[model samples]
Target: MLLITNVTAVTVDSQRRIITDAAIAVKGGRIADIGKAADLAPRHPDAELLEGHGMLALPGLIDAHAHSDQALLRGAADDLSWRPYLQEVIWPLLSRRTQEDAQISLRLCMLEMIKSGTTCFVDSIVPSHYDFDALAQAVQEMGMRGVLAKYVLPDALFGRGESPVDTGGFSGEDESLADAERGIGVWHGAAGGRLQVWLGPLVPREEPPASASPGFYRRVSRLAARHGTGITVHFAGTIDDPPFFQREFGMLPAEFARRYDLLGPNVLLINGTWFSEEEIPILAETDTRLVHSPSANMKMGEGFAKVPQMRNAGVTVALGCDAAANNNCHDMIREMKAASLLHNVVMMDPTTLTAEDALEMATIEGARAIGRRDQLGSLEVGKQADMILVDLKQPHTMPIHDPIANLVYAAHGGDVDTVIVAGQVLMQGRQVLVADEAAILEEAQERGLALLKRAGIEVAPAWPME
Candidate 1:
């Protein structure tokens, strides 16, 4: 049993309540009790106590969409638009990764995520030579909740129209499906139920030949449904995606998905920036979720998603930092701030999106995006104890008139002082406890250089370097 007392609890509950001088009791990986600090101290006299003076306790942040394999490629694709970056940099670099390289990258990603107060993330491993079992083991050892998926793409579409320029290493549909099944067999429900496996297919923008057919989607969807799992796909992020669908299939991406029975509560659509006004209702009607990567979308010059419209239409919108290579970091707090400001600027209405809205997207709505709302997300009684303590004593956080506003606008990921998941403390006072930080950083630096050299790719510095 663990008890945290003397803190301001920002319980993103039904009423969005905030309790001053509060206490939370955790036992058996669940929140047992929460009340005034003075009242709960005597009740849990024997429990291990943690003093949380000048701290704000809130639900741990969640990243609904991420690419763990891109950790090593940070800063390598700067200033390039989405299509060019995919064709010129990312796909070529992905072809050169080995199992060891991938393990190193995963470690770095997990390390960054933990230090940034992210207790849960939904990640897709790009198709490469990495060992899925090894990646799952690393995630388990780190003691963080994760939704892992194998990147499934049809071989016929690989290296073809609208895809990357170089896609020599991708697997065919049959092979990719087999690999996804193997991943499900090995990692789903592993780590004492902290890890889940999902099927991730790349929704091709261009019309695939009739020989390719809809059989690929039908097979994967049936398998996913049978296993009681979900499917995530990239949709309408680029200008090409929606236009391609309209020109080739005579409908929008959402309609195309609806034609194949792919839109539902279990489906998560990533980066729906190009979704037309008409598609918003379809997503709301089908109960499909959307994950907005504000930083990545803006960095790639892709137009912003109609987040305000989507949220108003009854669609759940969540936040994500897409990948280290694209966004250059995985800071959910930064993403939250970006999300709040981006839509406001795009709509030319300062009142379009609020600080509370951004925070909810990173918390409860993010849980719904990954289908874990009942167990994770909010800091509620009988819920899993996944939360973080943000130090409010920092200079940037001074004069805090509103806690949610301060959190979403002023604070950085470094403001997180403690992180707990499943009633276990993974980080305290900004120090990680589950892994060797020094060694992991050293190994990542060493492996990253070797990977760049092996891939024969050089990233020119924007400024002068020795």
Candidate 2:
């Protein structure tokens, strides 16, 4: 049990309350009570007290779309376009990494996430070469909520009209499905409900012969229903995805999803960059969740997602940083700032995505996307005690007029003073307490270079070197 006072709480509650000089009490890994510091401090005198230093206590940010396997691949293919990077650096990496290398990468990514106040994340799938048990063990040690996805390979890449990827050594579809089912049986509810296993079915832009069986999605849907779990997929992400769908299905991806019963509250689509105007309403009507990754979309040079329009259309649009290989960081605070500004500029309206809206997306709406909003989103009573302390007394964040505005515009990942998940402190004063941060940093540097060598992809500095 613990007590944190002298903090301004951004609850992200139903009323979106902002409590000044607030006190929050935690017991049994849940927020037990919340009120004024003067009112609640004396009641919980025996609880462990953490000095907030008048910082802003907000719900821990959630990365809705992440790649646990790609953290070590950051900056490996800098400045390369989407197709070349996917072909040369990203796809080959699926075959090149060993299980040990994967564990190190997962730890490295978790270390960054812990520092940045990311208490929960949905790790997108990479490949089966990376071991799941080792990855789950690493996440268990860190104590953060992880939606660990089981990668189920398709018969061929669906929707891959213009850009085609090589799947030479990939496992067959039946074997992949069986392996994923085994993962759900073993690790679905592990880590005392702190971890969840979900299916990650990869969707490519190829035609019928290269695509999965016609009944593939319906089959996966039934599989997920039988397991009582959820499934995530990438859809309508690229410029060619819609064209491929038109040539194959005679409709948009959302229509195709409807045909196969894929649209639902439990399903999460990664990036809908090319989603047409008509598809936004379909997502809203079905309660389908979509993650908006502004930095990654901009980095890939993909057209801006209709984020403002989607939000206006009542879609549950949460924010994500994608992967370290693309955005080069796993900082949700930075991602929030990028999202708040990017949409405003794109819409040419300063009120497009407000500070409050962006923060809500990072907190409550993010939890909703993951189907955990009831237990994980806000700093309300009966919710999980997952929150962060932002040091607003710092030089950059000094003289804060509006806490939410400053958080979305002024703050960065380093301003996060503490991170707590399930009432357990994972990081304090920017120092990670769960693992050796220095050791993981060293291991990631070594393993990242070794992976490049193993893949025979030399990355020389553009400038001449001695």
Candidate 3:
């Protein structure tokens, strides 16, 4: 049992309460109680005490969309348009990754995520010939929670789905489905309930007979429902996405998803940047979750999602750092700040997305995205003890007028001094507890170069060498 006392607790609960000089008690990997430090100290006298002066306790951030496999490609494919970048860079890089490369990439990915105060993430594993056991082991060893899935591209109505123009051919469609099934069977409920396996289908937006069929999605949805897991797919992300789907399928992406029974409480639609206003109601009515990756979208020239509109329409919107290749980092604090500022600037209304709104997206709403609302998300009693303590005494965060506002707008991921997930402290005082950080960093640097070499890609620095 652990008891953290003398902290400013930002309880993102039903009332969005903030309690100063408070304490939280943990027992059996769950939040046991929360109240004033003075009051709780006497009750749990024997609990291991953590001094939390000058700290702000809140629910650990949840990243609803991420691609851990792309963590090694940061800065290698920047400054390119989305489609070309995907076709020319990401796909090719993925093709050359080995099982050892993936394990190293995921370790680095988990390191960054844990350092950034992220307790849980939903990763869309890029399609490749790799080892799931190694990936799952890395995640488990790091003590991070994740929703892991293999990326599935269904066979198009015309024939097999089209691969990247430069890449030779798409792999077997039956094999892709089999891999997804095998992933679920092997990894679902593994890691002592710290990890879950989901189905991730790339949205069918390209022209048809090259587009994914309704039957494929229906089967995916059914499998997800039967497993009591979830399905995550990219939908209406680029400006051309909606139109392409509309022209090919005679409907918008959301409507098509709805018709195929893919829009439901168990579905998370990533990057709804191009969702038509008409589709908002469908999403709200179906209780579907939308994940917004502000930095990635802006970097890729994909327009910002209509988050304010979606919120007003009663839709649950969450936040994510899409991938390191696009966003260059998996810092949820930076993602939250980007999300808060992007909407306000796009709407030219400072009141559009408040700090509280952004924090909710990173925390509770994100839990809803991966279907873990009941167990994770908030700092309430009986919830899993997944939380972080941000040091407010830092220079940039000093004179904190409002802790929640400062957390969203001012604090950096490095401000997180301690992270407790499921009653276990994974990181304390800026140091990860589970893995050898220096070794992981060294391995990642070596493997990253080997990966680029294998893929026949060379990235030259733009500036002069020293």
Candidate 4:
């Protein structure tokens, strides 16, 4: 058992309370009690004490959308439009990655997330993972909670799904489904429910189909239902998605998903950058979830998503960093600031999305995205003791104004001094405890650059260097 005291707790609960001089007690991997430090100290007199004299405790941030592939290729494909960014840079770089390289990349991303106060994430794996054993092992070993989505491709259309240069992956349609099902059967509730397997289908026509029957879509939905899991797909990622869907399917993306039984409380839609104004309510009515990756959109020139409108319509919109290749960094703190400012400017309303709103997207709403709202995403008793302590004494994070506002607007990922998940301290005082940071960093740096080199890509500054 552990007790955290003398801290300010940003409890993103029903009342959105911020308790000063708060104390959070942990036992049996769950939050046991929460109250004023003075009141709780006597109750847990024998518990291991974690003092937070000048820190703020917030619910662990959740990355609703992420990619392990991009972590290895970050900064290797910068300053390119979406077209060349995909065709010329990303896909090619992905092809060069090895399975060993993948483990390193996964660790790299996990390390970054843990160091930054993210305890959970939903990763839309590219190409898809053939064997989830290694990935599952990595997650369990590192103690990070993740829903790893295997990219399920229609084998009839993409005979052999695009894969890494060295790692074997997705095959025929039936085989791919079987592989994914097998994964869920074996790993879905693995690691003491710290891991889950989700099915991912790329954006419609995003693969080489040019045309697709609803059969595959319905099959995946059924598969997910059978497994008691969820499906995540990119909805209207680009500006052309709406028109393409209309011309090809005679309906918009949300309507199409709804008809195919893909829009529901269990389904997660990424991007939603081009969901028509009419479709926003459809998303709300269906209780479908959408994740906003503002930095990724800005980097790829994908245009702004109507997040404020979606929120107003009662749609559950979460936040993510997407891929490091697109966003250059996976820190959700910076992503929150970017989201708040971006939407405000685009909507021409300074009050469009508040700092608190961005914080919720990364916290409580984020838990809602993964359908774990009750178990995680808030500092409440009986919830998983997943939390982070951000040092407010830092020079950059000073002023002692509204804690929520400062957290969303000012704190850097580096200012997160400690991270606790499942009542276990994974990182403390800027040092990781679950993995070998130095070895992982060194291996990933070399392996990542080698993958980029294998793809024949060169990364350098704009100006000449001697």
Candidate 5:
């Protein structure tokens, strides 16, 4: 048992209340209690105590929509548009990635995420069989909580302007269910259920006739429901996405999902950037959760998500960093900033999104995204003790008028001093406890460059060092 005391705890509850001079007790990886430091100290006298003076404890940030495997190509594909970059560069590179590459990327992303104050994430890796073992091992080694799902497509999904068939010249339909079952069996409930298993279907609409039957998605949805796991899919990103679904399926993305019984308790829609006002009601009426990536969406010229509108419509909104290849960084701080600004600007109301709302998207709402709200979202008593200690003494964060506002607007990843996940410290004083940062960085750079070269792509010349 561990007792973390003497910190200002930002509970991030509905009232956006902050408890000063407070402490949280952790037992068996769950937050045992939280209250005023003086009041709670006597209750857990024998527990391992962690003093949190000069720090502000917040619920560990969550990344709802990230491609953990893209960590290897973090800065490599920046300054490019979405389509050409993913089609010409990223997709080709993904085809050649080995299990070794996946493991390295997973580790690299996990380390970066922890440093950025993200305790948990939902990764969308390329559709491949090797990721099952690679990511399972990588998550265990890294000590991060996440839902690792294989990126599945009925056919070759992204290299061409139009979707391509699998390499075998036949459809890759069976691959989806196979990978789903394989991932759930091995990784679900691992790490005492801190790590979740999920299914990610790459295609937003129905599969090709040669690839799968209409019942294929039904079976996939049913399987996810049966196992009580979450399903994440990139439903709509641009103006074209909804129309594309409409043309093929004769229904909007949300309508289509509902018609096929896909809208349920365990489904998350990534990047609902193009959702129309009409569709908002349907989404809110269903159990589907929405994961919004403002940085990536804006970078791709996708307009800001209707977050304020969605929230007003009673929709659950979660934040994601998306792929580093697109956003170019796995920084939840930057995402929070963008989310706050975008909503305020779009709504023409500065108070449209409070700092507390932005923080919830990164923490509690994100946990709700992957259906882990019961355990991993907040810093409340009886919740999992996944939290971060932010250095409030930093220059930018000093003179803190409002702790929540300072956190959303000023504090960056560098301000994160300690990160605790499930009662275990994964990082302290910016030092990762589970892996060597130098080794991981070196391996990712070399492997990523090698893969980029093999795909016949050239990069910008390195800058001269002083």
Candidate 6:
């Protein structure tokens, strides 16, 4: 048993409550209890104690949608438009990568994720030889939890009549399903039940005519319902995308998905930045969740996702970094800040997104987006012991008037001093204990340089440079 006491715990419950001078008891990798420190001190006398002075505890952050394998190409495609980057560069580079690269990429990404406030993530699938088992193995070694998706693209149609023939990498639906099955069998329940398996339709709405399977979505829904797992697919992010459904099927993108019975609890709509107002009500009524990636959407020139409207309409909104090449970083705090800023600009009201709401999206809603809300979202009793302690003594964090406000508006990953997952200490003082930080950084830099050369591009200066 372990007891973390003397911390100001912001239990992000339905009330958005905060408990001062609190202590949390962890037993058997689960939060045993949480209450006033003085009351619980004598109850758990034998448990190991962790002094949490000058700390603010909150539920572990979750990255609902992430391309974990893209960590290798961190800076390779900055300043490039999304279409050319995806077609002319990323896909080609992806075809040449190996399983080893995928695992190493996941390791590096998970480390970065941990350094940020993300204790959990949903890792999207990649094309080039996805060794799901090896990927899970690497993430587990970091004491992080994730839902590993085995992405199956029945055909490579990116909508708008673009087919796999354009890319020269097409596989049958059955073959892709077989690959998913193999991945599920290998790592679905591995890592002491810390990992979950989910079905990934790489781009459900994007398939060429010859390769497109009209009934493919129904099959995916059936599989997920049968297995009691989640189904994730990219939707409504590309402007060029919706026209395909309009021309070919005479329906909008969201309408097309709805007509095929693709909206519900099991379906997670990834990157719904292009969703129309008409689609918002459908998502709300059908109980569909969304993965909102602000930085990537902006970088790709995708317009703002109607975040305030989506939240108002009862859509479960979660934050993600998308991928390193697209967003250039896996920092959830930056994502959080982006989310708040974007909503304020779009809504023309600084109060549109509150600090508390931003924190909720990063924690509870994010966990729900990937279907892990019951176990990993909040710091409540009976949930897995996953939370981060942010040091309040940092100069930027000094004179903190409101904990949640500072966390949302000003606090960064560097302020996080401790991370606990499943009652295990993964990092202390921002130093990861289970992984080699220096070596991982070294390899990541080497791989990134190689990726830039292969993609035939020079790295652009960091975000605000000329």
lDDT, residue 348, candidate 1: 93
Tell me, by TM-score, which candidate is best: 4
lDDT of 4 by residue, 194-243 (tens): 99999986557634554355778899999999889988887888887788
* Estimated TM-score for each candidate: 0.95, 0.96, 0.96, 0.97, 0.93, 0.93
- lDDT by residue for model 1 (191-221), tens: 8789999988766566333222356777778
> Each model's number of backbone clashes?
0, 9, 1, 1, 0, 3
Candidate 3: misplaced stretches above 4 Å? 126-128, 157-162, 165-171, 207-209
Q: What is the Cα-based lDDT of residue 217 in candidate 5?
A: 65
lDDT of each: 0.86, 0.85, 0.86, 0.86, 0.79, 0.80
Which residue pairs of candidate 6 clash? Answer: 157-206, 157-207, 157-208
Model 6 compared with the native: what TM-score? 0.93
Q: What's model 5's TM-score? A: 0.93
Once model 2 is optimally superposed onto the true structure by TM-score, how far is the C-alpha of residue 320 displaced, in angstroms? 0.9
Q: Which candidate model has the greater lDDT, 1 or 6?
A: 1
- Angstrom error at residue 451, model 1: 1.2
RMSD (CA, Å), each prediction: 2.2, 2.5, 2.1, 1.9, 2.9, 3.0
Error of 3 at 288 (Å): 0.8
TM-score, candidate 3, is 0.96
Model 6, runs deviating above 4 Å: 155-171, 205-212, 454-466
- The 10-residue segment with the lowest total lDDT in model 6: 162-171
Query: What would you estimate as the lDDT of candidate 1?
Result: 0.86
Q: Least lDDT summed over 10 consecutive residues: which range in candidate 5? A: 205-214
Residue 444 CA displacement from its true place in model 4, Å? 0.8
Candidate 3, residues 336-398, lDDT tens digits: the string is: 999999999999999999998999999999988888889899999999999999997988888
